[model samples]
Target: MTETPGASGAPSVRLTAGDAEVTILPAAGCRIASLRVGGLELLRQGDHYGCFPMVPWCGRTAQGRFRNGGVTHQLPINAAPHAIHGTGRDVAWDRLPSLEENEAVFSYELAEPWPYPGRVVQSFELTPDSLRLTMGVETADDSFPAQAGWHPWFRRNLGGEDVAVDFSPVWQEERGADHLPTGDRIEPRPGPWDDCFGMPDGVDVALTWPEQLRLRVTSPTPWVVVYDEQPEAVCVEPQSGPPNGLNTCPRLVTKIDPLEITASFTWERLG
Candidate 1:
């Protein structure tokens, strides 16, 4: 692991494992600066992982209005017409006291002035074994239910046409039009995949490379959304709740009347 100074005086943290080297920007929302395995960039730069937000981002209702506990509370859509990843990703975080050279922790308070009144802290630690990312979200108000997760873009060799993912459990099929759940479970088959899988009791899932590398993600989140945009890239997102879980399935939402939610993901390279 190596520490360097990033642009605008941000702390640049770097970690190397097998054939991957990952860099994280602690000040710019702790976003991933770079992810390269075997000298190949997996996270698309100038496209994704920019100075946007910290990981374990949050998603509220488009209008910040949802029915909870038989009451409807309105929330302002920070991003007009759509509720985007919560404030943690966009806000500057406070660097915490550290003891490990390969690890970095950042904390931020999402107050009532914001659309959502919550406190979120994210930590990114790189070691000789793998890269560990963790996030914790807590709310001062007890009535708001929030959802959060990671949206990482994994590097894939699309030209080989042999890239495939081995999911841990059956996934709920989504309506082609709205991309929401259809309440039906189906097995993995051929063709394009843009669906979320309800993770079933597993610490790790394998993503096999055609000829070069195999990546495994060990996460505490119970679901993983796999998106395969042909000729673009593959995104295997580890999420705490299902997509549109708040709007569609009310039970999946995390209730925080003084609420707290935590999730993590660990990535390791295997040859």
Candidate 2:
């Protein structure tokens, strides 16, 4: 399928299968504006960022405030003192008609500086090499704390070479000095990273473009961040907690508990 004119005007959506292609923008925040595989182009061609979707709360929620029970809420710093990646990629998304053509669905609504009152629902499925993603956050009345993830900029050089980031991660959240996450957990530090990693047996990672393609990002969500210092692009981010995690590991999204997360990338091609 295909369309154009999105980013609030609504329309963008493309998907193929065998040789893989994707280009969903559903009003921009449904992001993933391109992901060609055999024909190359692994993301990062931009409309701000290629693969985005980090709702309710995902990374950095420190100075932007948090605390739900007694009420704290602040937000809106927009990555200066914290409060990065949330507000659902900065709004606009609501596509859901799905007859199936690689699967798609989107939704949004979690207003203000996000004091509560939620909705966020995302889904995509694409498959040729793989791309499944899913996200959630709900609140019929209100509860609070939330998180979800996927922030793939990718593309560190896909002409062949310059994308190496494999992962094992068991610990490593020691990042502070305003980068947030200093609850300490250290040990896997090395990357040209922005920090945060812990696998709990999920959240796998790998980017490798040594000869061509290799993307493997998986995620049952145990947390992941890994920014590659950016010469161009390379972020892993599978987040669902960590990075102030709504004032340190919280995760309640009322109306009968709703706050889900998922990620999957899967790829292969090297020669």
Candidate 3:
């Protein structure tokens, strides 16, 4: 366990077991800043390193507008015409009291543009062979809507070996001009996909770096977005809902039933 000094004075925690090490930033959106196996790094460090959690709502909200209980709420357009990801990643997270070396927990309260008074909690647990992540949202007042997930920008190559994605999705959600899902489910399409897919049984994606490392990402959610447009990095996002799920298929979060989701990324050394 360790902490790094930053501008915001945010503390970074590092967990090491055997030849594996993982670093996380609790203040900076509670993101995993780095993950290394043996001596090789698997996740990309672009602008922000490793992966970050998406809470309150995952992905984007079309035009940043959504209707709830006969009222239309408009969110900030962080990504031009839409609100990509959620406000959680752009704000600081409060660290929760914990004494474990391999485990850390952080929480963020709902704020403006979200229109809901709630709280999101994210927890990370790391071991020698795998990393488990869990996210949840709850409100004391009325029921609202929410979603959660992780956006991991994986390195395209590991030890000079190119990475290849392998997954069997039932259908792909057709994309529109603005990159939003068009509500049409088509057959499994080709690679270089920046679209969402429907995995009825759940989301299970295998990213293989040839003979170096092969990581499997699994989640209970039925939606996953695969973006491999760039040659430097590929993103396999395990989201609770699609890009425009708020407007397409909103999942109500009641006082008794808060939205919760969990996902894991486990890897093995390839021969």
Name the top TM-score candidate: 3
TM-score of 2: 0.36
lDDT (tens digit, per residue) of candidate 1 on 1-271: 5778876566677766565577777666667767665575656564345323422233334454556667765545655654555555665678776677666777787764354455676667665445676776665555445565666666556245445666656555554454555666677555466777766673356667666556676676666667677555566666666655556555322343332333333444443
* Candidate 2 C-alpha lDDT tens digits along 83-183: 77887876778887878878888898888878767788898888899989888889969688888888889889977568888889899988878888778
RMSD of 2: 13.7
lDDT of predicted model 1: 0.59
Q: Give the TM-score of candidate 1.
A: 0.76
Q: Clashing pairs in model 1? A: 19-38, 53-89, 54-89, 64-75, 142-256, 142-257, 142-258, 256-259
The candidate with the higher TM-score, 2 or 3, is: 3
Q: How well does candidate 2 score on lDDT at residue 130?
A: 93
Stretches of candidate 3 above 4 Å error?
Answer: 6-9
TM-score of each: 0.76, 0.36, 0.95
**Higher-ranked by lDDT: 2 or 3:** 3
When 1 and 2 are scored with lDDT, the better candidate is 2
Using lDDT as the measure, name the better of candidate 1 and candidate 3: 3
- How many pairs of residues in model 3 come into backbone collision? 0
Count of steric clashes across candidates, in order: 8, 0, 0
Candidate 2: what lDDT? 0.83
Residue runs of model 2 more than 4 Å from their true location after superposition: 1-16, 19-67, 71-97, 104-120, 127-134, 150-163, 166-180, 183-206, 216-235, 240-244, 248-268
Worst 10 residues of 1 by lDDT: 252-261
